[model samples]
Target chain A: MAGLGQTLGRAATWPLTLAARAVDPPLRAWQRRTGTGGMAAVFLAPNLLIFSVFVLVPLVLNFAYSMTGGTGILLGQRPFVGAEQYARLLECQDYTRPITCREDQFWTAVGNTAQFVIFQVSLMVVVSLITALILNRDIRGRSFFRAVFFFPVLLSPVVVGLIWRWILQRQGLLNLIMVKLGLEPEVWLNDRVYAFAATIGVSTWAHMGFYTLILLAGLQAIPRDLYEAAEMDATPPGRVFWRITLPLLGPNLAVVLVLALIRGVQIFDEAYVLTGGGPGTSTLYLTQYIYESGFASLLREPGLAAAASILMGAVLVVLTLIQLWLSRRAEGRKAR
Target chain B: MGRIVLDGITKSFGATQVIHGIDLEIEEGELAVFVGPSGCGKSTLLRLIAGLDRPTSGRIEINGRDVTRASAADRGLAMVFQSYALYPHMTVRQNLSFGLENTRMPKPEIAERIDEAGRMLEIGELMERRPTQLSGGQRQRVAIGRAIVRNPTAFLLDEPLSNLDAELRGTMRAELARLHARLATTMVYVTHDQVEAMTLADKIVVLRGGRIEQVDTPLGLYNRPQNLFVAGFIGAPNMNFFRVRATGGQAELPGGLSLAVPGEGEVTVGIRPQGLHLATGDGPALEVVIRLVEALGAETVVHADAADGTPVVTVLSGQPSLAAGQPIRLAFDADAVHFFGADGMRLEA
Candidate 1:
C-alpha cells in the first residue's frame, strides 16, 4: 500500500518537475545576463509597478489637486490658487472655537478626531493588554476566550459598525434591555456625548484583537523560569508585574501604543457607518469631513477636501515616523 | 538554621506520576546532592522540596514548621535555575536587590547586601552590566548572588552547574564547595553527573525511575552500593557484570572460571574497572582477548572479551604493553568482588 502511494505521489509531481525543467534554462540565462542585483530588481518589478500606480501616482495627484480651486475635479478646468486653500482652512479668529473659523466643520472634525484618538488609543491599549494577560494564563477555556476576543478583527469594518449600531440603536438590544428594566429608554445615537463615546468604544472593540494577539505573543516569549525564580525570591505580585513583566513587555507595549495611535487617528469607517457624523457633528471625524467636502455634499469643493486630506496625510506620516523611531530605539537597546 | 524534612512526598501530573513516595531529611548546613539519569525525577524532587511545586500527597517541614501548603514566596526558599534566569533588563546589582526591595528592606541594607554578595561571588566589577553583557560564568555568579542576597531558609539548585562548560563546571564546583563552607546553609542540589555529586556532596541520593535507589555518603556509595543499579551507576565507565551459577560458596563463570562468592543459585558478580589488574603468574584469573585499549598518562584502560564472550573492562596502572586482539590474563582480589542475588540486591557475606 505504501509503495503504491509513493508511486502515485511521484506521478502527481511529474508535471511540476517537467515544467521546472522547461523553465530552468531561460531563468538561468536571464540570471547570467542580469547579475544578482539586477535579478532582484526583476523579481521585485511586479510589486513595485503596482505600488507606483496605486500609491505614488495618487499621492502626487493629491498634492497637485490641493493647490487648485473651484468645484471642478479635473486639474485643467480649475485655476491654480497656490496655498489659498491652506490659508482659508487656517483662517480662524480663535483656534479653540470652531464657530470663529471659515471651515467650521473642518475645525469641529479636527477637535473630534483629537478627542477620539486620545480616548480610543489609551482605552484600546489598556483593554488589549488586560485581555492578553488573562489569555496568557493557564486557565480553562483560554484558547476559546482568545478566539472570542479576536473574532471582531476578522469581521469587516462595515459589519462591525452595523453590529454595534444594532445593539445601541433606540429600538435595538441595549434599549430593549433598558426598557425591560423599567428605565427610560434613550436614543443612544441621537445624544452627542453618548454617540461620541459609542464611536470610540465600537472602534476599540473592532481593532483591539490584533493588538491583543501581538501582546499575547510577547507575553509567551518571556521564559517561564524567570517567573519561577521571582517566586523563589518571594517577590510580591505587584512588584513582579512592574519589575519583571512590564519592563520585559516594553518593546511590545511601544509597538501597540504607536499602532493604536495611528489606527485611532484613521478611525473613520466604523464611526461613519454607525453615527453618520450625527448629533450636531459631534462624531464628524477628519476623514468623514474630507469625504463630505470632496464628494458627498452638494456644494462639493474638491480642492479644499484635497488640501485637508494632504494635511491629514502629513499628520499620519509624522506619526508613522515616530513609530519607526520608537521601534528602532527598542531594537537598538536589544542589540546592545 | 536551614533543616528541611520531606515526609511521604509524591507528585503526579494528571494520570502520570513522576515522583513516587520519598522521605528525606536534609540537616542544617549539609550539602545534599541528588544524582540520577534524565527522567529520574531528581529535579522534580528538588522542586518539591523548594516549594516551587507541591507534592500530590505529602508534608514538608522546614525548621520544624509545616510548609507543605505554603506559597513559594511564603516558604522563604531561594533557587538557582539551570539557565541562570537572570532578569535581562536589570543590572546585576538590581537583580541582586530586586527580591530584597520587595520585602521593604531598608535601601541602605539592600545596597549593603548587594555589595556583600558581589564581593563574595567576585562579581563586584560586573554589577553595572546587564545579564546579556556578562559571560556564562559571570551570569552564573550573578544568579548565585541573587539567591544569596535573599538569605532564605535554604537553597535549592536544580542542575545549576549543568549549563556551564566542563572546565568552568569544575571551577564552579570548587567555588560552590567554598561557598557552602562559608555560609553553612542547608542546600539541595540536583544533577545527573555523579562526579559532581561525589566531589561536592556531604550526602548523596541516587535515584532511578522516580524512586530513591540509595542514599549514603559519597565514599559509602562508592565502596558499598545497595543494589546493582547503584553499583553500576556510581562509577565511571560503569562496573562490569558477569552472569554465573553458584553452588554452595563457589560460583562458575561462563568462561569456565570459578570464583568463591557469598551466594548460591543464580548469581551476578560486579567488579569496578580499577579493581582488575594484569596477571603476573598462575592465579585465579580470567583470560580475555583485548578488544580496545585507551592509555591515559598515568593509567591504561582495556576493553576485553572472555572466551565465552563476556565483555570486561580493566583499568591497569602504568603504560603496560597492550594492544587490541592480544590475549591477556586479568586478576582480581576477592575483596573487590561484589555478589548480587537473583533480585539484583547486593548479597551480604
Candidate 2:
C-alpha cells in the first residue's frame, strides 16, 4: 500500500514538476527583480481594471450627466448645464411642504422616499430583530421555521414585488380573505394611503428575510456560556436581553439599520410593480421618479434623473459612513 | 447558612445517562469539590446543584428548602463558569452588580457590595475596566468577585481555573482556597485537576462514569482510596499497579518477587511512586531496569519495567544515582503498600 501510494504521489507530481521546470526560472527571475509590490500589482491588476471600467467609469459618467443638458447620444453634442438640474430639484418654497414647492412632483418623490425610508427601515430593523430572536430559540423545527422566514429573501426583488402585487391587488387573495372574515372589500392598490402602506409592507416583507438572516447569524455568534452565566447570576430575562444580548448584537444591528436605510431610500421595484406610483402618485419613491424621468414616463429627463440619483448616492454614502463609524466605535470599545 | 442535600440524583441527555443516581450531603460552610475526569459528570453534578441544569430523577434541597423545580434565579445560588463568563460590554463593577440590580437591591448596598468584593479580590482598581481589559487571572478574580457580590446561599464554581495558564492557575487556586477560608460558605467546586481537589477541598468527591467512587477528605482519600479509580486519580504521577496472587500471608508479583501481603487469591497491588525506596529497608526487592528518569531539583522520578514487563515507577527524594537502561532493585515499606481485589475494590492495605 505504501509503495502504491508513493508511486501515485510521484506520478501526480510529474506533470507539476515538468510545468515548474518550464516556468520556474522566469518566475524566479521576475521575483528577484520586481519583488512583492510588483507581484501584488500583477495580482490586483484585473480587479482594478474591472472596477475602473464598470464602477468608476459609470460613476464619473453619472456625475458628468448630472451637469449636462439635452438627450444627445454623443457626449460632444450634449451641452453643460452646470448644476441647473440640481438647482431645479432644489427650488422649493417652504421646503417642509412638498405641495408648496416648484417641481412639486420631484419634491413629492423626495417626500415620499423620506417617509418610506423612515417607516420601512425602522419597521424592518425591529421586525427582523424580533424574528431573529424567536428563531434563535430551541423551538421545535427551528431550522424549518428559519428557512420559512428566510425563503422570501432568496427570491428576486422583481419576483417578490410581482408575488405581493398578485396577493394585494383588488379582488386578490388578501381582499378575498378580508371579505371572508366579514371585512369591507375596499380597494387596496388604488387608495392613496393604503397603496403607500401596501408598498412599505410588501417591501418590508420581501427584504426582512435577508436582515433576519444577518441578525440570526449575530445571535448565533454569541457565546452560550454568557447566557448560562447570566442565568446563574439570577439575572431576570428582561435584564439579560437588555444588558447582554442587545449589547453584544450591536455591530450586526448597525449593519441592518444602515443597509435597510440605504435600500429603503432606493426602493423602486415593489412600489413600481404593486402600485405603479398609485392613482395620485402617493407611493412614488425616489428611485421610481428617477426611473420615470430616465426611461419610463414621457418626461424622459436624463439630467434630472442623474441629479436625483447623485443625491440618492450621497444619502447612501452617508448611511454607509455612519455604519462604518458605529461599528468602528463598537470594535474600539470592545478592544480594551 | 448553606446546606445542600441531594437524594437519588440522576441526569440524562436523551439516552446518554451522565449522572447516576447518587445521594450526598454538603454541610454549611464546607468547601466541597467534585473531582473527576472529563465527561465524568462532575460539572453536570455542579450544574444540578446550581439549578443551571435539572436532575432527571431526584430531589435537591438548598438550605433545607426543596428546590427541585425552582428556577436558577429562585434557587439563590451563584456560579462562576469555566470561561469566566463576564459581560464583555460592561465594566467589572456593573458585571458584579447586575444581579443585585435585578433584585432591586438598594443603590448604597450594591455599591458597597461591589466595592467590598473588588477589594476582597484585590480588583478594586479594575472595577472601571471592562472584562476585555483584564488578564486571564484578573478575569477569574472578577468572576469570583461577581459570585461574591451575589452573596447567595452558596457558590458553585465550574472549572474556574481551567482557562488560566499554569502559573496563574496556581495563584488563582490559592486565592480561591483563601476565599473559601474567609467566606466559609457552602461552596461546591468542580474540577478535573486533582491537585486543585487535593489543595482546596474539605470533602473531595471522586466520580467515575457518573458514579461517586469515593467521598472523603483530601488526606483520607490520599491515605486510603476506596477503589482503583480513586487511587489512580487522586495522586500526581498516579499510583502504580501490578498483578499479584496471594497465598496465605504472602503475595507473589508477576515479576517473581514475593512480599508479605495479607490477602488470598488473585489481587492487584497498588503502590505510590513515593512509596518505592532503595533496597536497604526491604520486605521483598524487585529488580527493575530504568526506562526513563525525570530529575527535578527536590525530587527525581524513575520509570522502569520489571522482568516480566509490568511497569514500575519510583519517586526518590533528591537526586538518585540512576540512569536510563540501568538495572536497580527497589523495595517499599509494607504499610505503604495497598491491595485491591479483582473487582477493583480496596482490600487489606
Candidate 3:
C-alpha cells in the first residue's frame, strides 16, 4: 500500500519538478548577471507598484489640488492661486478666538483637535498600559479577556461610534440606568463639555486594544529570569515595577506613544459619527473639517480642504519619522 | 547564621508533580551543590529555597524561622541565574546597588557596598557600562556582584557558569571558590556538571527525577555511591558494569574471567575506567579487542570489546601502544571492584 501511494505521489509531483528544472537555468543566469541586490529589487517590484499607484499618486495630486483655487472638483478646471488658501487658513486677528479668523470653523476644529489629542492620547497610553499589564498576567480566562478587549478594534469605526451612541444617547441605556439609580439624566450629546468628552472616550475605547497588544508583546519578550532575580533581591513590588518592568518596557512605550499621537490627531470617524461636530462645533476635529469643506458643505472649497489635509499629513509624517527612529534605536540596542 | 532546613518539601504544577516530597538541611557557611541531569528539578529545588517558588506541601525554616508563606523579599535570600539576569538598562554599579537602595540603606553605605562588590568582582572598570556592553564572563561577574551586595542570609546560584565557554568556566570556577571563601556565607548551587560539583562542593547532593539519590562529600559520592544511579552519574566517562554469576565470594565474569566478590546469585560489578590496567601476568582476566584509543598526552583512554562482545573502556596513565582489533587482557584490583546485587543496590563490603 505504501509503495502504491509513493508511486502516485511521485507521478503527481513530476510535472512540477520538471517545470522547476526548466526554470532553474534561466534563474541562475539572471542571478549571476544581476547579483543579490537586483534580485531584491525584483522581489520588491510588485509591492512598490501598488504603493506608488495607491499612495504616491494620491499624495502628488493632493499637493497639486492644494495649490489651486475655485470650487472645481477637477484639477485642470481650477486656476493656480499659489498660497492663497494657506494664507486664508492662517489669517487671524487674535490667534486665540476663531471668530477673528477668515476660516473660523477650521480654527475651531484645530483648537478642538489639539484639546482632544492631549486628553485622549494621555488617557489612551495609561489605559492601554494598565490593560496590557493585567492581560500579561496568568489570570483565569486571560485569553478571553484579551479577545473581549480587542473586539472593538476589529469593528468598523462607524460601528464603534454607533454602539457607543446607543449607550450614551439621551433616554438610552446609560440614562435609564442613571434614572434607576435615583440620578437625573442629562442630554449627553447636547452639552458642549459632555459631547467633547464623549468623543474622546469613544475614540480611546475603540483603538486602545491595538496599543495594549503591542505592550503585551513587549512585556512577554522581557526575560522571565529578570523578574526572578528581582524577587530574589527582595525588592518591593512597586520598586520592581519602577526599576525593572517600566524601564524594560521603554521601547514599546515609545512606539505606543507616537502611534497614539498620530491616531489622536487623525481622530474623526468614530467621533464624527458620535457627535456630528455638534453642540456648536464642540467636537469638530481636523479630518471632519477637511471633509466638510471639501465634500459635505454647500460651498465646497476643495483647495482649502486639500491645504488642511496637507498640513495634517505633515504632522503625521513627522510622527512616523519619530517612530522609525525610535524603533531603529531599539533594534540597535537589542543587537548590542 | 544562615542554616536552612526543609521538611517534607514537594512542588506540583497543576496536575504534574515536578518535585516529590524532600527533606534537606543546609548548614551555615557551607557551599552545597546539587548536581543532576536536565529535568531533575535541581533548579526548582533552589528556587523553592530562595522563595522564588512556593512548595506544594512543605515547611521551610531559615535560622529557625518558618518562611514558607513569606514573600521572596521577606526571605532575605539572593540568587544568581543561569542567564546572569542583570538588568540590561542599568549600569554595573546601579545593578549592584539596586537591592541596597530598595532596603533604604543610606546612600554612603550603598556606595560603599557597590565599590566593594566592584573591586571584589574586578568589575570596577565596567561600573558605568550596561550589561550589554560586557562579555559573558563579565556579565556573570556583574550578576554575582548583584547578589553579593545584597549581603543576604544565603545565596542561591542556578547554573551560573553554564553560559560561559569552557575556558572561561574554568577561570570563573576558581574565582567563585575564592569568593565563597571570602564571604563565608551559605550557598546552595545547582548544576548538571558533575565536575563542577566535585571541584567546588563541600557537600554534593545527587538528584534524579526530582528525588535525592545521594548526599555526601565529593569523594564519598565517587568512592561509594548508594545505588546504581549515583554510581553511573557521579563519574566522568561513566563507571563500567559487567554481569557476573557469583557464589561463595567468587564471581565468574564473561570469557572465563573470575573475581573475588561477595554476592549470591546474579551480581553486577563496576570498575572505574581509571581502575583497569594491562594485565601483567594474568591468571584470570577479561580479554578484549581494542576498538578505539583516545590519547590526551598525559593519559590515554582505550575502548575495546570483551570476548563475550561486551564493550569495555580503560584509562591508562601514560600513552600505551594501542590499535584497533588488537587483543589484550585487562585486569582491575580487587579492592577497586564494586559489587551490586540483582536489585541494583551496592553490596556492603
Overall lDDT per candidate, in order of appearance = 0.91, 0.88, 0.91
Q: Against the correct fold, how does model 2 do in TM-score?
A: 0.93
Task: At residue B43, give the lDDT of candidate 1.
Answer: 89
Residue ranges of candidate 3 with Cα displaced over 4 Å = A1-45
| lDDT tens digits by residue: candidate 1, A263-320 | 8888889998899998889999999999999999999899999999999999999989
Pairs clashing in candidate 1?
none
TM-score of each: 0.94, 0.93, 0.94
Model 3: per-residue Cα lDDT over B104-151, one tens digit each: 899999999888898999999999999988999999999999989889
User: In DockQ, how does model 3 score against the reference complex?
Assistant: 0.75
lDDT of 3 by residue, A60-80 (tens): 998899999999999999999
Docking class of 3: medium
Tens digits of per-residue lDDT, candidate 1, B137-233, equal: 9999999999999997789998898888999999999999999999999899999999999999999999998899999999999989889999999
> Which digits, one per residue and each the tens of the lDDT, describe model 2 over residues B1-349?
9999999999999999999998999999999999988889998899898888899999999988999999888888999999888988899988998888888989999999999998899999998998888999999999999999989899999999999999989998898889899999999999999899999999999998999999999999999988888999888788989888788868877557888775678788999999988787544587899999999969999999988899988899999888999988888788888888889899864
Q: Name the regions of candidate 2 deviating beyond 4 angstroms.
A: A1-33, A329-336, B281-283
lDDT score for residue A260 of model 2: 92
Q: Which structure among the candidates has the greatest DockQ?
A: 3
Question: Model 3: what TM-score?
Answer: 0.94
